[model samples]
Target: MSSLAKQLTGVVANTRKLLDLCGSLQAENDMLKLEVQSLKVAVDTSIDKNKQLEEKVKALTVARSLDEVEVGEAGINEKILDTKQKINDFVREIDKCIELLK
Candidate 1:
Protein backbone atom coordinates (compact mmCIF):
# COMPACT_ATOMS: atom_id res chain seq x y z
CA MET A 1 0.00 0.00 0.00
CA SER A 2 1.07 3.57 -0.62
CA SER A 3 2.30 5.64 2.37
CA LEU A 4 -0.41 8.27 1.68
CA ALA A 5 -3.14 5.59 1.69
CA LYS A 6 -1.82 4.15 4.94
CA GLN A 7 -1.80 7.62 6.52
CA LEU A 8 -5.38 8.24 5.41
CA THR A 9 -6.48 4.92 6.86
CA GLY A 10 -4.90 5.80 10.23
CA VAL A 11 -6.65 9.16 10.18
CA VAL A 12 -10.04 7.52 9.50
CA ALA A 13 -9.50 5.02 12.33
CA ASN A 14 -8.62 7.83 14.76
CA THR A 15 -11.69 9.78 13.70
CA ARG A 16 -13.94 6.78 14.30
CA LYS A 17 -12.44 6.30 17.76
CA LEU A 18 -12.99 9.95 18.55
CA LEU A 19 -16.62 9.74 17.40
CA ASP A 20 -17.22 6.70 19.53
CA LEU A 21 -15.72 8.43 22.55
CA CYS A 22 -17.89 11.46 21.94
CA GLY A 23 -21.00 9.33 21.70
CA SER A 24 -20.18 7.69 25.01
CA LEU A 25 -19.55 11.07 26.66
CA GLN A 26 -22.83 12.38 25.31
CA ALA A 27 -24.76 9.47 26.80
CA GLU A 28 -23.08 10.01 30.17
CA ASN A 29 -23.89 13.71 30.01
CA ASP A 30 -27.55 12.93 29.36
CA MET A 31 -27.66 10.56 32.31
CA LEU A 32 -26.09 13.17 34.54
CA LYS A 33 -28.67 15.72 33.42
CA LEU A 34 -31.49 13.34 34.31
CA GLU A 35 -30.01 12.75 37.72
CA VAL A 36 -29.67 16.49 38.29
CA GLN A 37 -33.31 16.98 37.31
CA SER A 38 -34.43 14.31 39.75
CA LEU A 39 -32.38 15.89 42.51
CA LYS A 40 -33.93 19.26 41.76
CA VAL A 41 -37.41 17.74 42.03
CA ALA A 42 -36.56 16.23 45.37
CA VAL A 43 -35.13 19.51 46.58
CA ASP A 44 -38.27 21.36 45.53
CA THR A 45 -40.44 18.85 47.36
CA SER A 46 -38.35 19.27 50.47
CA ILE A 47 -38.64 23.03 50.23
CA ASP A 48 -42.41 22.81 50.01
CA LYS A 49 -42.48 20.56 53.04
CA ASN A 50 -40.29 23.01 54.90
CA LYS A 51 -42.62 25.86 54.05
CA GLN A 52 -45.56 23.88 55.41
CA LEU A 53 -43.68 23.14 58.58
CA GLU A 54 -42.79 26.77 58.97
CA GLU A 55 -46.43 27.77 58.62
CA LYS A 56 -47.45 25.25 61.24
CA VAL A 57 -44.78 26.54 63.58
CA LYS A 58 -45.94 30.09 63.06
CA ALA A 59 -49.52 29.11 63.90
CA LEU A 60 -48.39 27.30 67.02
CA THR A 61 -46.35 30.31 68.05
CA VAL A 62 -49.34 32.59 67.67
CA ALA A 63 -51.50 30.22 69.67
CA ARG A 64 -48.88 30.09 72.40
CA SER A 65 -48.64 33.86 72.49
CA LEU A 66 -52.39 34.13 72.88
CA ASP A 67 -52.31 31.62 75.69
CA GLU A 68 -49.55 33.56 77.41
CA VAL A 69 -51.47 36.77 77.14
CA GLU A 70 -54.46 35.12 78.76
CA VAL A 71 -52.46 33.70 81.66
CA GLY A 72 -50.39 36.83 82.16
CA GLU A 73 -53.56 38.81 82.92
CA ALA A 74 -52.36 41.77 80.86
CA GLY A 75 -55.99 42.28 79.56
CA ILE A 76 -57.93 40.91 76.60
CA ASN A 77 -57.97 44.16 74.58
CA GLU A 78 -54.20 44.55 74.70
CA LYS A 79 -53.72 40.94 73.65
CA ILE A 80 -55.95 41.50 70.64
CA LEU A 81 -53.85 44.43 69.52
CA ASP A 82 -50.66 42.43 69.86
CA THR A 83 -52.15 39.57 67.91
CA LYS A 84 -53.21 41.93 65.13
CA GLN A 85 -49.75 43.38 64.88
CA LYS A 86 -48.20 39.91 64.70
CA ILE A 87 -50.66 38.89 62.03
CA ASN A 88 -49.77 41.94 59.97
CA ASP A 89 -46.07 41.19 60.26
CA PHE A 90 -46.68 37.60 59.19
CA VAL A 91 -48.66 38.77 56.18
CA ARG A 92 -45.88 41.09 55.13
CA GLU A 93 -43.32 38.30 55.37
CA ILE A 94 -45.48 36.03 53.26
CA ASP A 95 -45.82 38.76 50.65
CA LYS A 96 -42.07 39.16 50.55
CA CYS A 97 -41.64 35.46 49.97
CA ILE A 98 -44.20 35.52 47.16
CA GLU A 99 -42.37 38.39 45.49
CA LEU A 100 -39.07 36.58 45.78
CA LEU A 101 -40.52 33.44 44.23
CA LYS A 102 -41.82 35.45 41.32
Candidate 2:
Protein backbone atom coordinates (compact mmCIF):
# COMPACT_ATOMS: atom_id res chain seq x y z
CA MET A 1 0.00 0.00 0.00
CA SER A 2 0.97 3.62 -0.55
CA SER A 3 2.26 5.56 2.43
CA LEU A 4 -0.63 8.06 2.19
CA ALA A 5 -3.15 5.24 2.12
CA LYS A 6 -1.65 3.75 5.27
CA GLN A 7 -1.87 7.12 7.05
CA LEU A 8 -5.48 7.49 5.96
CA THR A 9 -6.32 4.05 7.30
CA GLY A 10 -4.80 4.92 10.70
CA VAL A 11 -6.80 8.17 10.80
CA VAL A 12 -10.03 6.34 10.02
CA ALA A 13 -9.37 3.83 12.79
CA ASN A 14 -8.71 6.61 15.33
CA THR A 15 -11.87 8.45 14.25
CA ARG A 16 -13.97 5.33 14.73
CA LYS A 17 -12.49 4.81 18.22
CA LEU A 18 -13.23 8.43 19.11
CA LEU A 19 -16.81 8.10 17.84
CA ASP A 20 -17.32 4.98 19.97
CA LEU A 21 -15.97 6.77 23.00
CA CYS A 22 -18.31 9.70 22.37
CA GLY A 23 -21.30 7.35 22.12
CA SER A 24 -20.36 5.63 25.35
CA LEU A 25 -19.99 8.96 27.13
CA GLN A 26 -23.38 10.13 25.87
CA ALA A 27 -25.10 6.99 27.15
CA GLU A 28 -23.47 7.33 30.55
CA ASN A 29 -24.51 10.98 30.74
CA ASP A 30 -28.13 10.11 30.00
CA MET A 31 -28.16 7.42 32.70
CA LEU A 32 -26.66 9.78 35.24
CA LYS A 33 -29.29 12.43 34.45
CA LEU A 34 -32.09 9.91 35.08
CA GLU A 35 -30.52 8.86 38.36
CA VAL A 36 -30.29 12.48 39.45
CA GLN A 37 -33.95 13.08 38.67
CA SER A 38 -34.99 10.02 40.68
CA LEU A 39 -32.90 11.11 43.63
CA LYS A 40 -34.47 14.57 43.56
CA VAL A 41 -37.94 13.06 43.75
CA ALA A 42 -36.94 10.88 46.65
CA VAL A 43 -35.53 13.87 48.47
CA ASP A 44 -38.71 15.82 47.95
CA THR A 45 -40.79 12.97 49.30
CA SER A 46 -38.59 12.68 52.32
CA ILE A 47 -38.92 16.37 53.00
CA ASP A 48 -42.70 16.15 52.89
CA LYS A 49 -42.68 13.21 55.28
CA ASN A 50 -40.47 15.10 57.67
CA LYS A 51 -42.87 18.01 57.66
CA GLN A 52 -45.77 15.73 58.49
CA LEU A 53 -43.85 14.13 61.33
CA GLU A 54 -42.98 17.50 62.76
CA GLU A 55 -46.62 18.55 62.77
CA LYS A 56 -47.63 15.35 64.50
CA VAL A 57 -44.99 15.86 67.15
CA LYS A 58 -46.18 19.39 67.75
CA ALA A 59 -49.78 18.26 68.14
CA LEU A 60 -48.82 15.50 70.52
CA THR A 61 -46.76 17.91 72.59
CA VAL A 62 -49.66 20.30 72.94
CA ALA A 63 -52.02 17.49 73.91
CA ARG A 64 -49.59 16.20 76.51
CA SER A 65 -49.22 19.64 78.03
CA LEU A 66 -52.96 20.02 78.30
CA ASP A 67 -53.31 16.64 79.93
CA GLU A 68 -50.62 17.48 82.44
CA VAL A 69 -52.33 20.75 83.31
CA GLU A 70 -55.70 19.07 83.87
CA VAL A 71 -54.19 16.45 86.14
CA GLY A 72 -52.27 19.01 88.15
CA GLU A 73 -55.14 21.44 88.62
CA ALA A 74 -58.25 19.34 89.30
CA GLY A 75 -57.63 15.59 89.53
CA ILE A 76 -55.42 15.57 92.62
CA ASN A 77 -57.56 18.03 94.59
CA GLU A 78 -60.71 16.06 93.85
CA LYS A 79 -59.12 12.82 94.97
CA ILE A 80 -57.95 14.35 98.23
CA LEU A 81 -61.39 15.79 99.02
CA ASP A 82 -63.09 12.54 98.25
CA THR A 83 -60.76 10.65 100.56
CA LYS A 84 -61.30 13.14 103.42
CA GLN A 85 -65.06 12.79 103.19
CA LYS A 86 -64.90 9.03 103.22
CA ILE A 87 -62.68 9.01 106.29
CA ASN A 88 -65.05 11.35 108.17
CA ASP A 89 -68.01 9.10 107.37
CA PHE A 90 -66.08 6.03 108.56
CA VAL A 91 -65.25 7.67 111.91
CA ARG A 92 -68.89 8.62 112.53
CA GLU A 93 -70.02 5.07 111.88
CA ILE A 94 -67.43 3.74 114.30
CA ASP A 95 -68.62 6.17 117.00
CA LYS A 96 -72.22 5.07 116.49
CA CYS A 97 -71.20 1.43 116.85
CA ILE A 98 -69.36 2.16 120.08
CA GLU A 99 -72.42 3.91 121.60
CA LEU A 100 -74.64 0.99 120.62
CA LEU A 101 -72.24 -1.43 122.31
CA LYS A 102 -72.16 0.62 125.51
Candidate 3:
Protein backbone atom coordinates (compact mmCIF):
# COMPACT_ATOMS: atom_id res chain seq x y z
CA MET A 1 0.00 0.00 0.00
CA SER A 2 2.86 2.41 0.77
CA SER A 3 4.47 1.81 -2.63
CA LEU A 4 1.20 2.34 -4.39
CA ALA A 5 0.68 5.63 -2.56
CA LYS A 6 4.11 6.94 -3.69
CA GLN A 7 3.36 6.07 -7.31
CA LEU A 8 0.03 7.85 -7.18
CA THR A 9 1.63 10.95 -5.64
CA GLY A 10 4.25 11.14 -8.37
CA VAL A 11 1.59 10.80 -11.04
CA VAL A 12 -0.48 13.62 -9.52
CA ALA A 13 2.56 15.91 -9.34
CA ASN A 14 3.42 15.32 -12.98
CA THR A 15 -0.13 16.00 -14.03
CA ARG A 16 -0.15 19.31 -12.21
CA LYS A 17 3.07 20.34 -13.89
CA LEU A 18 1.69 19.48 -17.28
CA LEU A 19 -1.46 21.47 -16.58
CA ASP A 20 0.66 24.51 -15.63
CA LEU A 21 2.70 24.22 -18.81
CA CYS A 22 -0.43 24.00 -20.90
CA GLY A 23 -1.89 27.09 -19.27
CA SER A 24 1.29 29.07 -19.92
CA LEU A 25 1.36 27.97 -23.55
CA GLN A 26 -2.25 28.98 -24.03
CA ALA A 27 -1.57 32.48 -22.70
CA GLU A 28 1.41 32.86 -25.01
CA ASN A 29 -0.67 31.79 -27.99
CA ASP A 30 -3.30 34.38 -27.21
CA MET A 31 -0.70 37.13 -26.94
CA LEU A 32 0.86 36.14 -30.26
CA LYS A 33 -2.50 36.21 -32.00
CA LEU A 34 -3.22 39.71 -30.72
CA GLU A 35 0.19 40.89 -31.84
CA VAL A 36 -0.37 39.45 -35.29
CA GLN A 37 -3.67 41.29 -35.61
CA SER A 38 -2.05 44.56 -34.62
CA LEU A 39 0.73 44.12 -37.10
CA LYS A 40 -1.78 43.40 -39.85
CA VAL A 41 -3.63 46.62 -39.12
CA ALA A 42 -0.43 48.60 -39.22
CA VAL A 43 0.58 47.05 -42.51
CA ASP A 44 -2.80 47.83 -44.06
CA THR A 45 -2.55 51.46 -43.02
CA SER A 46 0.89 51.77 -44.54
CA ILE A 47 -0.34 50.34 -47.81
CA ASP A 48 -3.17 52.85 -47.97
CA LYS A 49 -0.87 55.75 -47.25
CA ASN A 50 1.54 54.56 -49.91
CA LYS A 51 -1.22 54.45 -52.47
CA GLN A 52 -2.25 58.00 -51.64
CA LEU A 53 1.31 59.19 -51.97
CA GLU A 54 1.63 57.50 -55.33
CA GLU A 55 -1.47 59.27 -56.56
CA LYS A 56 -0.11 62.61 -55.45
CA VAL A 57 3.15 61.94 -57.26
CA LYS A 58 1.26 61.17 -60.45
CA ALA A 59 -0.69 64.39 -60.22
CA LEU A 60 2.48 66.37 -59.67
CA THR A 61 4.10 64.74 -62.67
CA VAL A 62 1.17 65.73 -64.87
CA ALA A 63 1.26 69.28 -63.59
CA ARG A 64 4.98 69.49 -64.27
CA SER A 65 4.47 68.26 -67.82
CA LEU A 66 1.79 70.88 -68.41
CA ASP A 67 4.12 73.58 -67.15
CA GLU A 68 6.84 72.45 -69.53
CA VAL A 69 4.39 72.61 -72.44
CA GLU A 70 3.34 76.14 -71.47
CA VAL A 71 6.95 77.28 -71.27
CA GLY A 72 7.63 75.80 -74.72
CA GLU A 73 4.63 77.64 -76.14
CA ALA A 74 5.89 80.90 -74.72
CA GLY A 75 9.27 80.35 -76.39
CA ILE A 76 7.53 79.69 -79.71
CA ASN A 77 5.55 82.89 -79.35
CA GLU A 78 8.76 84.86 -78.83
CA LYS A 79 10.22 83.38 -81.98
CA ILE A 80 7.10 84.35 -83.94
CA LEU A 81 7.37 87.91 -82.71
CA ASP A 82 11.02 88.08 -83.79
CA THR A 83 10.10 86.80 -87.26
CA LYS A 84 7.36 89.43 -87.64
CA GLN A 85 9.79 92.19 -86.72
CA LYS A 86 12.26 91.03 -89.35
CA ILE A 87 9.57 90.98 -91.99
CA ASN A 88 8.52 94.54 -91.16
CA ASP A 89 12.12 95.72 -91.47
CA PHE A 90 12.45 94.11 -94.92
CA VAL A 91 9.27 95.80 -96.13
CA ARG A 92 10.57 99.22 -95.03
CA GLU A 93 13.84 98.63 -96.86
CA ILE A 94 11.98 97.64 -100.04
CA ASP A 95 9.82 100.81 -99.87
CA LYS A 96 12.91 103.01 -99.43
CA CYS A 97 14.53 101.43 -102.49
CA ILE A 98 11.40 101.97 -104.58
CA GLU A 99 11.09 105.63 -103.58
CA LEU A 100 14.75 106.33 -104.46
CA LEU A 101 14.29 104.72 -107.89
CA LYS A 102 11.16 106.75 -108.59
Candidate 4:
Protein backbone atom coordinates (compact mmCIF):
# COMPACT_ATOMS: atom_id res chain seq x y z
CA MET A 1 0.00 0.00 0.00
CA SER A 2 3.03 2.30 -0.06
CA SER A 3 2.51 2.99 -3.78
CA LEU A 4 -1.16 3.75 -3.14
CA ALA A 5 -0.21 6.20 -0.40
CA LYS A 6 2.27 7.94 -2.69
CA GLN A 7 -0.39 8.31 -5.37
CA LEU A 8 -2.83 9.85 -2.87
CA THR A 9 -0.21 12.35 -1.69
CA GLY A 10 0.52 13.40 -5.26
CA VAL A 11 -3.15 13.83 -5.94
CA VAL A 12 -3.55 16.07 -2.89
CA ALA A 13 -0.67 18.29 -3.91
CA ASN A 14 -2.07 18.71 -7.42
CA THR A 15 -5.49 19.52 -6.05
CA ARG A 16 -4.04 22.21 -3.82
CA LYS A 17 -2.19 23.75 -6.72
CA LEU A 18 -5.40 23.79 -8.77
CA LEU A 19 -7.24 25.49 -5.95
CA ASP A 20 -4.57 28.16 -5.71
CA LEU A 21 -4.74 28.81 -9.40
CA CYS A 22 -8.53 29.12 -9.21
CA GLY A 23 -8.26 31.64 -6.41
CA SER A 24 -5.79 33.73 -8.35
CA LEU A 25 -8.07 33.68 -11.39
CA GLN A 26 -11.01 34.77 -9.29
CA ALA A 27 -9.12 37.81 -8.01
CA GLU A 28 -8.09 38.78 -11.52
CA ASN A 29 -11.68 38.44 -12.71
CA ASP A 30 -12.92 40.73 -9.97
CA MET A 31 -10.37 43.39 -10.87
CA LEU A 32 -11.35 43.17 -14.52
CA LYS A 33 -15.01 43.62 -13.60
CA LEU A 34 -14.25 46.80 -11.69
CA GLU A 35 -12.20 48.16 -14.56
CA VAL A 36 -15.03 47.44 -16.98
CA GLN A 37 -17.47 49.30 -14.77
CA SER A 38 -15.21 52.33 -14.58
CA LEU A 39 -14.77 52.34 -18.33
CA LYS A 40 -18.53 52.17 -18.81
CA VAL A 41 -18.97 55.24 -16.67
CA ALA A 42 -16.37 57.09 -18.69
CA VAL A 43 -18.06 56.09 -21.95
CA ASP A 44 -21.45 57.30 -20.71
CA THR A 45 -20.00 60.63 -19.68
CA SER A 46 -18.37 61.05 -23.07
CA ILE A 47 -21.65 60.31 -24.82
CA ASP A 48 -23.41 62.97 -22.77
CA LYS A 49 -20.70 65.51 -23.51
CA ASN A 50 -20.90 64.74 -27.22
CA LYS A 51 -24.66 65.27 -27.20
CA GLN A 52 -24.26 68.65 -25.56
CA LEU A 53 -21.67 69.64 -28.12
CA GLU A 54 -23.99 68.55 -30.94
CA GLU A 55 -26.77 70.75 -29.57
CA LYS A 56 -24.42 73.70 -29.36
CA VAL A 57 -23.40 73.16 -32.98
CA LYS A 58 -27.03 73.09 -34.04
CA ALA A 59 -27.67 76.36 -32.25
CA LEU A 60 -24.64 77.94 -33.89
CA THR A 61 -25.84 76.84 -37.32
CA VAL A 62 -29.25 78.33 -36.70
CA ALA A 63 -27.71 81.59 -35.56
CA ARG A 64 -25.55 81.76 -38.68
CA SER A 65 -28.52 81.19 -40.96
CA LEU A 66 -30.53 83.86 -39.24
CA ASP A 67 -27.66 86.31 -39.47
CA GLU A 68 -27.36 85.65 -43.21
CA VAL A 69 -31.04 86.33 -43.87
CA GLU A 70 -31.75 89.20 -41.49
CA VAL A 71 -28.46 91.01 -41.02
CA GLY A 72 -28.23 94.58 -42.35
CA GLU A 73 -25.38 97.08 -42.36
CA ALA A 74 -26.81 98.57 -39.19
CA GLY A 75 -26.67 95.27 -37.24
CA ILE A 76 -24.10 93.26 -39.17
CA ASN A 77 -21.27 94.15 -36.85
CA GLU A 78 -23.26 93.17 -33.78
CA LYS A 79 -24.28 89.87 -35.31
CA ILE A 80 -20.68 89.13 -36.28
CA LEU A 81 -19.54 89.80 -32.78
CA ASP A 82 -22.24 87.54 -31.31
CA THR A 83 -21.32 84.72 -33.67
CA LYS A 84 -17.66 85.08 -32.81
CA GLN A 85 -18.46 84.85 -29.13
CA LYS A 86 -20.51 81.69 -29.66
CA ILE A 87 -17.67 80.15 -31.67
CA ASN A 88 -15.19 80.91 -28.92
CA ASP A 89 -17.44 79.39 -26.32
CA PHE A 90 -17.82 76.27 -28.42
CA VAL A 91 -14.05 76.00 -28.76
CA ARG A 92 -13.61 76.28 -25.00
CA GLU A 93 -16.13 73.52 -24.41
CA ILE A 94 -14.33 71.26 -26.88
CA ASP A 95 -11.08 71.95 -25.11
CA LYS A 96 -12.67 70.96 -21.82
CA CYS A 97 -13.82 67.65 -23.27
CA ILE A 98 -10.35 66.97 -24.62
CA GLU A 99 -8.85 67.67 -21.24
CA LEU A 100 -11.26 65.27 -19.60
CA LEU A 101 -10.29 62.51 -22.02
CA LYS A 102 -6.62 63.10 -21.38
Candidate 5:
Protein backbone atom coordinates (compact mmCIF):
# COMPACT_ATOMS: atom_id res chain seq x y z
CA MET A 1 0.00 0.00 0.00
CA SER A 2 3.00 2.33 0.33
CA SER A 3 3.68 2.08 -3.42
CA LEU A 4 0.02 2.76 -4.14
CA ALA A 5 0.18 5.90 -2.00
CA LYS A 6 3.25 7.19 -3.85
CA GLN A 7 1.58 6.61 -7.19
CA LEU A 8 -1.52 8.54 -6.12
CA THR A 9 0.64 11.41 -4.88
CA GLY A 10 2.36 11.60 -8.23
CA VAL A 11 -0.92 11.63 -10.04
CA VAL A 12 -2.20 14.44 -7.85
CA ALA A 13 0.93 16.50 -8.46
CA ASN A 14 0.61 16.07 -12.20
CA THR A 15 -3.04 17.01 -12.06
CA ARG A 16 -2.18 20.19 -10.19
CA LYS A 17 0.45 21.08 -12.76
CA LEU A 18 -2.00 20.53 -15.62
CA LEU A 19 -4.59 22.69 -13.94
CA ASP A 20 -2.03 25.47 -13.41
CA LEU A 21 -1.02 25.38 -17.04
CA CYS A 22 -4.64 25.49 -18.16
CA GLY A 23 -5.31 28.50 -15.96
CA SER A 24 -2.33 30.36 -17.37
CA LEU A 25 -3.40 29.60 -20.91
CA GLN A 26 -6.86 30.88 -20.21
CA ALA A 27 -5.41 34.13 -18.85
CA GLU A 28 -3.27 34.54 -21.93
CA ASN A 29 -6.28 33.92 -24.15
CA ASP A 30 -8.25 36.60 -22.32
CA MET A 31 -5.40 39.10 -22.72
CA LEU A 32 -5.24 38.32 -26.43
CA LYS A 33 -8.97 38.85 -26.79
CA LEU A 34 -8.68 42.30 -25.22
CA GLU A 35 -5.83 43.17 -27.49
CA VAL A 36 -7.83 42.10 -30.54
CA GLN A 37 -10.73 44.23 -29.41
CA SER A 38 -8.46 47.27 -29.06
CA LEU A 39 -6.96 46.67 -32.48
CA LYS A 40 -10.40 46.41 -34.05
CA VAL A 41 -11.36 49.71 -32.49
CA ALA A 42 -8.21 51.26 -33.84
CA VAL A 43 -8.94 49.98 -37.30
CA ASP A 44 -12.44 51.36 -37.15
CA THR A 45 -11.09 54.76 -36.15
CA SER A 46 -8.62 54.71 -38.99
CA ILE A 47 -11.34 53.83 -41.45
CA ASP A 48 -13.46 56.72 -40.26
CA LYS A 49 -10.56 59.11 -40.62
CA ASN A 50 -9.90 57.81 -44.10
CA LYS A 51 -13.52 58.36 -45.05
CA GLN A 52 -13.34 61.96 -43.80
CA LEU A 53 -10.21 62.56 -45.79
CA GLU A 54 -11.79 61.09 -48.86
CA GLU A 55 -14.73 63.40 -48.49
CA LYS A 56 -12.40 66.39 -48.25
CA VAL A 57 -10.61 65.24 -51.36
CA LYS A 58 -13.87 64.88 -53.27
CA ALA A 59 -14.99 68.36 -52.28
CA LEU A 60 -11.66 69.85 -53.22
CA THR A 61 -11.79 68.11 -56.57
CA VAL A 62 -15.21 69.54 -57.28
CA ALA A 63 -14.16 73.03 -56.18
CA ARG A 64 -11.09 72.93 -58.35
CA SER A 65 -13.09 71.66 -61.28
CA LEU A 66 -15.49 74.56 -60.88
CA ASP A 67 -12.61 77.05 -60.81
CA GLU A 68 -11.21 75.59 -64.00
CA VAL A 69 -14.64 75.58 -65.61
CA GLU A 70 -14.36 79.38 -65.94
CA VAL A 71 -11.47 78.80 -68.38
CA GLY A 72 -14.15 78.27 -71.08
CA GLU A 73 -16.06 75.61 -72.94
CA ALA A 74 -14.16 73.05 -75.04
CA GLY A 75 -11.42 71.86 -72.68
CA ILE A 76 -13.42 72.57 -69.51
CA ASN A 77 -15.94 69.90 -70.49
CA GLU A 78 -13.20 67.36 -70.87
CA LYS A 79 -11.71 68.36 -67.53
CA ILE A 80 -15.12 68.02 -65.85
CA LEU A 81 -15.64 64.57 -67.33
CA ASP A 82 -12.18 63.50 -66.17
CA THR A 83 -12.91 64.82 -62.70
CA LYS A 84 -16.13 62.82 -62.55
CA GLN A 85 -14.33 59.65 -63.54
CA LYS A 86 -11.69 60.27 -60.88
CA ILE A 87 -14.43 60.73 -58.30
CA ASN A 88 -16.02 57.47 -59.34
CA ASP A 89 -12.71 55.67 -59.11
CA PHE A 90 -12.12 57.12 -55.67
CA VAL A 91 -15.53 55.92 -54.52
CA ARG A 92 -14.81 52.43 -55.74
CA GLU A 93 -11.46 52.48 -53.99
CA ILE A 94 -13.15 53.50 -50.74
CA ASP A 95 -15.59 50.64 -51.13
CA LYS A 96 -12.75 48.22 -51.65
CA CYS A 97 -10.95 49.50 -48.56
CA ILE A 98 -14.10 49.08 -46.51
CA GLU A 99 -14.51 45.54 -47.73
CA LEU A 100 -10.90 44.72 -46.91
CA LEU A 101 -11.35 46.01 -43.37
CA LYS A 102 -14.42 43.89 -42.88
Candidate 6:
Protein backbone atom coordinates (compact mmCIF):
# COMPACT_ATOMS: atom_id res chain seq x y z
CA MET A 1 0.00 0.00 0.00
CA SER A 2 1.28 3.55 -0.72
CA SER A 3 0.51 4.71 2.79
CA LEU A 4 2.40 1.81 4.33
CA ALA A 5 5.46 2.51 2.09
CA LYS A 6 5.47 6.17 3.03
CA GLN A 7 5.31 5.36 6.71
CA LEU A 8 8.23 2.90 6.41
CA THR A 9 10.37 5.48 4.59
CA GLY A 10 9.63 8.08 7.26
CA VAL A 11 10.52 5.63 9.99
CA VAL A 12 13.80 4.81 8.28
CA ALA A 13 14.71 8.47 7.96
CA ASN A 14 13.98 9.11 11.65
CA THR A 15 15.98 6.08 12.72
CA ARG A 16 19.00 7.26 10.71
CA LYS A 17 18.81 10.66 12.31
CA LEU A 18 18.72 9.12 15.80
CA LEU A 19 21.72 6.95 14.99
CA ASP A 20 23.61 10.01 13.78
CA LEU A 21 22.86 11.80 17.05
CA CYS A 22 23.88 8.80 19.16
CA GLY A 23 27.19 8.85 17.38
CA SER A 24 27.12 12.11 19.43
CA LEU A 25 27.48 11.67 21.80
CA GLN A 26 30.12 9.18 20.94
CA ALA A 27 32.59 11.52 19.18
CA GLU A 28 31.90 14.31 21.65
CA ASN A 29 32.45 11.89 24.50
CA ASP A 30 35.78 10.85 22.99
CA MET A 31 36.88 14.46 22.64
CA LEU A 32 35.79 15.20 26.21
CA LYS A 33 37.77 12.25 27.50
CA LEU A 34 40.92 13.50 25.73
CA GLU A 35 40.44 16.99 27.13
CA VAL A 36 40.02 15.62 30.65
CA GLN A 37 43.22 13.65 30.32
CA SER A 38 45.13 16.71 29.13
CA LEU A 39 43.77 18.84 31.95
CA LYS A 40 44.71 16.21 34.54
CA VAL A 41 48.28 16.16 33.26
CA ALA A 42 48.50 19.93 33.42
CA VAL A 43 47.18 19.99 36.99
CA ASP A 44 49.61 17.30 38.11
CA THR A 45 52.55 19.14 36.57
CA SER A 46 51.51 22.36 38.29
CA ILE A 47 51.26 20.65 41.66
CA ASP A 48 54.71 19.11 41.29
CA LYS A 49 56.27 22.41 40.27
CA ASN A 50 54.64 24.14 43.23
CA LYS A 51 56.03 21.59 45.63
CA GLN A 52 59.52 21.92 44.17
CA LEU A 53 59.36 25.71 44.46
CA GLU A 54 58.21 25.45 48.08
CA GLU A 55 61.13 23.20 48.93
CA LYS A 56 63.54 25.61 47.24
CA VAL A 57 62.09 28.50 49.21
CA LYS A 58 62.59 26.61 52.45
CA ALA A 59 66.21 25.87 51.55
CA LEU A 60 66.84 29.49 50.64
CA THR A 61 65.32 30.63 53.92
CA VAL A 62 67.66 28.37 55.87
CA ALA A 63 70.61 29.60 53.85
CA ARG A 64 69.66 33.20 54.54
CA SER A 65 69.35 32.50 58.25
CA LEU A 66 72.86 31.05 58.22
CA ASP A 67 74.14 34.35 56.82
CA GLU A 68 72.59 36.20 59.78
CA VAL A 69 74.23 33.90 62.36
CA GLU A 70 78.02 33.98 62.70
CA VAL A 71 80.55 31.35 63.92
CA GLY A 72 83.71 33.40 63.01
CA GLU A 73 85.67 33.63 59.70
CA ALA A 74 86.08 29.87 59.22
CA GLY A 75 82.35 29.38 59.57
CA ILE A 76 81.75 32.20 57.15
CA ASN A 77 83.95 30.52 54.53
CA GLU A 78 82.12 27.24 55.02
CA LYS A 79 78.75 28.98 54.63
CA ILE A 80 79.93 30.60 51.41
CA LEU A 81 80.97 27.24 50.02
CA ASP A 82 77.66 25.70 51.03
CA THR A 83 75.80 28.56 49.38
CA LYS A 84 77.82 28.10 46.18
CA GLN A 85 76.96 24.41 46.19
CA LYS A 86 73.30 25.23 46.51
CA ILE A 87 73.54 27.67 43.62
CA ASN A 88 75.25 25.02 41.49
CA ASP A 89 72.55 22.51 42.32
CA PHE A 90 69.90 25.04 41.30
CA VAL A 91 71.71 25.66 38.02
CA ARG A 92 71.78 21.93 37.32
CA GLU A 93 68.06 21.67 37.98
CA ILE A 94 67.41 24.61 35.67
CA ASP A 95 69.51 23.04 32.91
CA LYS A 96 67.64 19.78 33.25
CA CYS A 97 64.31 21.59 32.97
CA ILE A 98 65.53 23.37 29.87
CA GLU A 99 66.64 20.09 28.36
CA LEU A 100 63.21 18.63 28.98
CA LEU A 101 61.61 21.55 27.17
CA LYS A 102 63.84 20.94 24.17
Per-residue lDDT over 1-102 for candidate 1, one digit per residue giving the tens place of the 0 to 100 score: 699999999999999999999999999999999999999999999999999999899889889878877544457778888889989999999899899999
Scanning candidate 4 in windows of ten residues, the lowest lDDT window is 65-74
Candidates ranked by lDDT: 1, 5, 6, 4, 3, 2
Q: Which stretches of model 1 miss by more than 4 angstroms? A: 71-73, 97-102
* Candidate 3 root-mean-square deviation in Å: 23.2
Candidate 5 residue lDDT tens string, 10-61: 9999999999999999999999999999999999999999989978988897
Off by over 4 Å in 5: 71-102
* Model 3 C-alpha lDDT per residue in residues 1-102, reported as the tens digit of each score: 999999999999999999999999999999999999999999999998997897577556545544555357787676566556655765886698799999
Instruction: Show the colliding residue pairs in model 5.
Output: none
Candidate 5 residue 45 Cα shift, in angstroms, is 1.0
Each prediction's RMSD over C-alphas, in Å, is 2.4, 21.6, 23.2, 6.3, 4.3, 4.2
- Cα lDDT tens digits for candidate 4, 58-100: 7979576555854566576766776778778879988998999
Candidates 1 and 4 compared: the better one by lDDT is: 1
* Candidate 1 displacement at residue 51 in angstroms: 1.9
Backbone clash tally for model 6? 0
Model 5 lDDT, full chain set: 0.90
In candidate 3, stretches whose alpha carbon ends up further than 4 angstroms from where it belongs are 71-102
Instruction: Give the worst 10-residue stretch by lDDT in candidate 1.
Output: 68-77
* TM per candidate: 0.78, 0.65, 0.66, 0.65, 0.69, 0.66
Tell how far residue 81 is off in model 5, in angstroms.
Answer: 9.9
**Cα deviation in Å at residue 50, candidate 6?**
0.4
Which pairs of residues have clashing backbones in candidate 6?
none
Candidate 6 C-alpha lDDT tens digits along 48-69? 9998998789687767867676
Which lDDT tens digits does candidate 2 get at residues 1-102? 699999999999999999999999999999999999999999999998997897577556545554555356577676566556655765886698799999
**Among all candidates shown, the one with the greatest lDDT:** 1
